[model samples]
Target: MTPIRRYATAPGVPAAVGPYVQATSAGGFVFTTGQIPAAPGQEIGTFADEVRATLTHLAAVLAEAGSGLDRIVKLNAFLGSPEQLDVYNQVYETFFTDHRPARTTVCVGLWGVALEIDCIAVTGPGGDA
Candidate 1:
């Protein structure tokens, strides 16, 4: 059997800057595109704010897909600089608190921003779930 796929679109979530949807769901899971703090080509502030904004985007995407940050099963993160990790984690903790998702963080070359993030979450409570 095939699981029908649904693309995600949420009001508060900014328009995706390129050829991609914010997220998609299938087989009881929502998978999001990597999200940045601001639209591509836009300048961002401190590493902490970047992390916060990106995660906030991720959460909004999830909420629109019938899930929430608490339901995240796994998260993948990219940091433009190794030094950004400490600040990133500090901001990240505020959003996650005790509900920790399985996660991976990597230092990578980014397109003018300090951070990017995405996640896979169980479809819980609403929308296409």
Candidate 2:
């Protein structure tokens, strides 16, 4: 027997600019693409704002796939610099108030963007997982 694999699409989330799906699920787990911090045509804001937007997109993708922020088991994030970690945590706390997933944040050479984030989560009852 073979397990099922599914591709997920998030409504209200602008189509991925690249050739990649927003999310995919298999074996009771959901994996998301790295969410860009800016919304469609929306200019990038402050470091905190960028983190908030990225997380919002991540949550939306998880919700669309029958998961959510609290369900996240692992989160991977990228930043333009290490100096913004404190500000990022302040904004991140607002989204992940109760459940905190294992996370990794790395400083990267990003162009015109402060952050990008992706996550893995457990599917809810609505999902096969």
Candidate 3:
């Protein structure tokens, strides 16, 4: 089993999972865990709000791993409700302003959150062209 490198800071986004790395870098790629709107016990507002908040945390994780959202090449989005799809896309477009990574949106019976997002990005120090 190969162990991926993990990065963390003294003051950074807190992880709810006990054994989750902020970001994992392996096999020439960086994989980030699913991010939810639960920010250190902050109450989640709306689906769009959760999506935006989660993405912000993901960006921070990428930064800690020497990467950024612009470098993301793929994403997996899980939504509790299908009706929020349009709003999710709108907020996603607003944040991922540069690289529009290939994405998969899944409508599930229930997510661990109102919105959840995980990403796979190239591990490097360049923004999308």
Top candidate when judged by TM-score against the true structure: 1
By descending TM-score, how would the candidates be arranged?
A: 1, 2, 3
Candidate 2: Cα lDDT at 56: 84
Off by over 4 Å in 3: 1-3, 8-11, 39-42, 126-129
Cα-based TM-score, every candidate: 0.89, 0.86, 0.83
As a whole number from 0 to 100, the lDDT of residue 50 in candidate 2 is 75
Runs with alpha carbons beyond 4 Å of true place in candidate 2: 1-8, 39-41, 126-129
* TM-score, candidate number 2: 0.86
Better of 1 and 2 by TM-score: 1
> Distance from true position, residue 120, model 1, in Å?
0.4
Q: Order candidates by lDDT, high to low.
A: 1, 2, 3
- TM-score, structure 1 vs. true: 0.89
lDDT string, candidate 2, 8-112, tens digits: 458656568767889988788888998877754577667777787788888889888878998998999898889989999899889988788899999998766
TM-score winner between 1 and 3, please give it. 1
For residue 127, what is the lDDT in candidate 1? Answer: 31
lDDT of 1 at 74: 92
- The whole-model lDDT of each prediction reads 0.82, 0.81, 0.78
Backbone clashes in model 1, listed as residue pairs: none
Per-residue CA lDDT of model 1 for 1-129, tens digit only, reads 647566656766668777778888888888999888877777667777778788888888888888889899899999988888788888988998878889999999987777889899988565322
